[model samples]
Target: MLRETWAEIDPGRIVDNLRAIRGTLPAGVKLMAVVKANGYGHGDLEAAEAARQAGADYLAVAFLEEALRLRAGGVTLPILILTPIRPDQAELAASQELTLTVTDAAWFRELRKGRPAPAPGGRKLRVHVKADTGLGRIGFRTEAEWDALVPWLAAPDIDVDGFYTHFATAGQADTAYLERQACRFAELMERCKASGIAVRHYHCAGSAAALRFPGLALDMVRIGAAMYGYYPPQLTPPVQLKPALSLHSTLMQVKRVRRGEYLGYDNAYRSDADEWIGTVPIGYADGWSQRMRGADVLVRGRRAQVVGKISMDQLMIRLPGPCAPGDRVTLIGRQGGERITFAELAVHIDGAAQEISTALTDRVHRICANEKEVQCPWSSPYFQPHRREATVI
Candidate 1:
């Protein structure tokens, strides 16, 4: 039998985060759960369903494929594609009734190609206006660009439902720059209001805004990390939200290492004392970053140091106690009344620099935690937790 080295997705913890987020939202504001990066590297199906059930008004993903997977999995709630959809996928976007981002009029014209003149059934496709703001990403850079597309947005086929921009530094404490950016955004929104934009929602904040600057929440918020139980660098984490994903693996071996003995590639680490050297089955291929070489993990309620370079299939860790194989290693999540988070891991790699999910891959399996700890669903329902909402995929 293959040893289970998988991710445990805790839906109940996600539910708790949503409830806390809802409490923080204003009276008329709604939460748009960001399920992008495959729910921030936690499985999408589980994250989306949990967020939807916990009262999120909508779910947001990065692209058409991500949204499609959710729809195919029978997710019923509204999904917003935060990124621009490819021209070829516009019809698919139209068919699924997904809200898409329009950065320019060229993409808009492409969406009109195979689409009916009046739009089939006279139903409108939800559309959101994307402004570059300060992120300098894929969005209309100027008011002139938005002005050129105003008329087409009024067309019967497109429903210009919202206007949004990304926050570049709202996560920082005393974000004066973001404050000034928000003022500028206010001016732009005023201009849109003067020009009769008729936007259904106006938002400029994302995960950072959801936690750090609540006043900027506006009509709604697009959140990801915080919903996954992490806050910005500046904000204090509340007690209500708990991390939903925990990565655990069994210790493969524990052997005594002599002083001056080399470990791993290039003798990256040498044991200073005649102590226990342990191996964890997970490695860089499993998203245990190379920078996490000196990182810490909880083994048997005590912190164990990751020594040497992480290989594709294995990694060496230094143990402080008389440890044995089959003991659990906590990579991301709480253990022994203590918690370790992905954000902390990211800090070890690059503080406030790298996107944590970018390093994670889909190779690892996702199994429900607690319910069936004895069995992993590599070939069973523990892995096939598909909920149906749409009759046809």
Candidate 2:
């Protein structure tokens, strides 16, 4: 990569994570690998390929555009779009054989009016019914809403592929809310069965729920964050998953500063004593925002505190001692015995680990750890330097 800062993605690690999660699942439980938000910023295509290699039964994205991109990348696994699409976009999604998430009966009415033409082989538009047991986000909330949607789902042109819900407190210390939601979903499933709607799959557990409560893996389990090693350990997950992404950079410039002197913009930091300061070529523009000012990074296996206001393209760190200009810097990974985790960084910003991983922008190039084995599918000039030409998002 041309940039001094880069993120390394290990496809093998993802594969291992998937396998570990799979080991905890019961037989005949399908695994749907969620690659939404660019695989939580680990690179969607790479994650999907890794999932496929590990025998994932299906793939899921948040929008139609994401599913279409995966199809263009030659991913043939059945892809389900988790978020509902515009009624007008139904045809395009159907044309690509993409499954869509349907929440409201009104949406189905709109879709039926602008009906997508039948496929060449009599293929029906596949759909998953989203039920809101809790979280109060999107989905049919009551039995009345489900009843209203039943007739529309019976249409000859559509297929009810799955029925699912999301748990808001799956990762929380309290399981009371999660149990209530699960019970509510169970009631809906029984109602669905009695309705004879012929729903093919039933799922409720996401990564945390699936790992913490295997019984929730009804017909399938949707593994997303945990597949990339981002789940909370407080859940005491049955399987162990390693992070597939790590960030690294080099110390571009290092200099000695006096205690009275200030560093960075607006004199954001003043050295308490004569200290060695090092500059790293990564800042907010690279997804390392100003809130990271007080964070610590690994410099030659030693912890160096970020001592100044992070700029758009660079950040300064208080070195443990005098360090060379070209010394390696570990931002979110292991160096000697020290390691910086996304969870640790997220704690500094009062957020989740996902916020840290997904915040990394495309400006920070990703170097695949095992490029030869699990080739990156992003089509960008930056990856052309590798043995095989590839791209990025």
Error of 1 at 67 (Å): 0.7
Q: Kindly list the per-residue Cα lDDT of model 1 for residues 318-362, writing each as its tens digit.
A: 997889889888777667676667677767876542265445665
Q: All candidates' lDDT scores?
A: 0.75, 0.87
lDDT (Cα, tens digit) per residue for candidate 2, span 216-272: 999999999988888874556677678888888899999999988999899888888
Tell me how far candidate 2 lies from the true structure as C-alpha RMSD in angstroms: 3.1
Candidate No. with top TM-score: 2
TM-scores, each model vs. reference:
0.90, 0.94
Would you list the clashing residue pairs of candidate 1? Answer: 74-389
Q: Where does candidate 2 stray beyond 4 Å?
A: 116-121, 378-393
